[model samples]
Target: MPGFTKHMYLNDLNKIKSDFSNYIKNIIQILSEEYNLDSIMYILEKYYPYECQILNEKYDYYCLKDKKLIPLNKKVRYLMPKPKSIIRGLKITKKILSKTYKDNYALNFDKNLQLENEELLKKEREPKINKIKEKIDKAKLKAQEVEPSFLDELMGLYERKRTTQKDKVYIFKELEKYYCLKVISFF
Candidate 1:
């Protein structure tokens, strides 16, 4: 059985009471087809005479089966089964309830409005990072692009006069590009 509630029924009743007369009329038609007109009419008159008056004012009517509000809206007309009948004819074989998990954006609708903002920020930073990387890569590429040559590995070696530290410095040229190799701090 589809769950029924007073709040849900009242909301639908208020909708029918406010605008759209067709909803009431459709329920009345269904009631006239299934039960005695006076019995259905008496039920409407007893509990919801105001609704009946609203229908009468608008040349409409309504009916109730059990306590469910059977609105005749085209979208929901076929859903109104008889009272006490289970809606088992439905072909549903699977039922799952979604679990809720909190996220940073869950409390902020604005965060979802700008999913592209993070992506855009990332895209914006990528080019700048790439530009810096390219400069470093170009410097290395230019060094490697030069013609190959060989030079003496050790033209000189010196030890500091005041300290035992070797303070080694190796300077050389490869393909007209100078590279400074220094042993500043040894592990």
Candidate 2:
């Protein structure tokens, strides 16, 4: 009997089902449960001399054959014809020309170029004029508004009390104590 190797039997079980006879299928199925259909197909197409034969017009009426599978059709080699290039013997060349003259052509070409620069300078000076106007407006507003005296508020917080001598002495003692504590903590 034609026997398959362990690796072959394990990997080509599905191929045997599709390509081989009932005897070969049963033998492969009984020999191993693990089979990779894609790897087996790849091996058959790439390594082995496999053949497919159409028995009838129907798609189902087909047979596959190899050394492991049932023999069916004659060996037919299919070759893809070499592709022909349409643009054969074509050469591409690029030439970049640079002006050799040293004279400034841009100034000669545009008469209004100096006028454009003058306009641009005028436009640049507009922001400075606007800034001066804004400063004058701010000065005018400040002149109209009354300013609050922060010094007056600070002086009021430290103003002396018109109390009796005993009360004044007690207040001065408390102030001295608070200042001493603050200075010690700061150090």
Mark the regions of model 2 whose C-alpha exceeds 4 Å error after superposition.
1-111, 145-187
- Estimate TM-scores for all models: 0.25, 0.18
lDDT of each: 0.36, 0.32
Candidate 2 clashing pairs, residues 3+ apart or interchain: none
lDDT of 1 at 165: 36
Instruction: Give lDDT tens digits, candidate 1, residues 95-182.
Output: 1001121132233335343455445544654576567668868776655443223323232323335432343333322223533232
lDDT of residue 32 for candidate 1:
22
**Highest lDDT against the true fold, candidate:** 1
The superposed Cα distance between candidate 2 and the true structure at residue 41, in angstroms, equals 96
lDDT of 2 by residue, 1-187 (tens): 4434434533443343344332222222111122233333332332222221111111121221222143445342211111111011111100001122112232243436545643554465457556766985775564423233442342343455656667655544434332222222222
Which prediction has the highest TM-score against the true structure?
A: 1
Model 1 clash pairs are none
